[model samples]
Target: RSIHVDSPPSVPSLTTSYVHGTSSVSLLYQTVGQRLDSTVQRWPEREAVVCVQDGIRRTFSQFQQDVDKAAAGLLALGLRPGDRLGVWGPNMYEWILFQFATAKAGIILVSLNTAYQANEVEFALKKVQNATDVAFKSHSLTSLTQS
Candidate 1:
């Protein structure tokens, strides 16, 4: 299948160097949840995630279960598909779970850097708020931040 556009851009890009591959392979249009489900079906017992700091490990099946639960929780909190959810945390197993959870929940995940100060986070939240409707009615970042 061709991935090229039917028509080129009306405006000319004088410095752009666009290239399309001539390979016979077609792209797999699937979400992260779909791919995870496929992997679990193929290799349920295979190791999917491991956090060195916490010594946390999980197989594909376990990972899928946790991600599904988190996704459900997000939905329960009134976050629907296309809703924006901002996640602020450091690199941890929980963060990975939310990464997959957001994708599975069909909510856009706005990853806030762990190093971001309170002011920066406020600015980011405001910035995204201006562009899209961010859901924070029930799912607050209070627990994730320093008290």
Candidate 2:
């Protein structure tokens, strides 16, 4: 005797199952000190960074401590997750610190052109309407300004 075969039917759906978007780097730590705890694993006994212009040299362990301090300072200033931080200036050691701190504290960063004049700075500030605090190279000629 021969067996009969049946074909399976296909169905279509309107909604798509998956989508791709910009990738995110996670800096969340279990506690404020956890960031320091994790860095030792990857950068143990390494010269993590040095800033010649500022005469600053720090090993990985030292760098991790500085980051923790900066993160703590930001938290003390009332910054919290989902807050926007705007940084505009020539890249420097402090600039890098602010970037890492913002990420670790879950704040969004908006970079503004340091060359922008007062009028331009106003425009950029308006563009990132949610920015709560601004970090810059010089307090007087900083990149962040309100419109």
Query: Which candidate's lDDT is highest?
Result: 1
Q: lDDT score of model 1?
A: 0.75
Residues 113-143, model 1: lDDT tens digits: 8788889988988877722323223323223
RMSD of each: 7.6, 12.6
Q: Per-prediction TM-score, please?
A: 0.72, 0.64
TM-score of 1: 0.72
- Model 1 regions more than 4 Å off: 1-25, 130-147
* Range of the 10 consecutive residues with the lowest summed lDDT in candidate 2: 138-147
Per-residue lDDT of candidate 2, residues 1-147 (tens digit): 433334333454437644333334433547534655577778767877777776767787877766667767777778888888777767677777777767777777777778888898788778768656564646321222111
Q: State the C-alpha lDDT per candidate.
A: 0.75, 0.65
Candidate 2 off by > 4 Å: 1-37, 137-147
Query: 15 in model 2: Cα distance from truth in Å?
Result: 18
Q: Model 2: clashing residue pairs?
A: none
Give the TM-score (vs. native) of candidate 2: 0.64
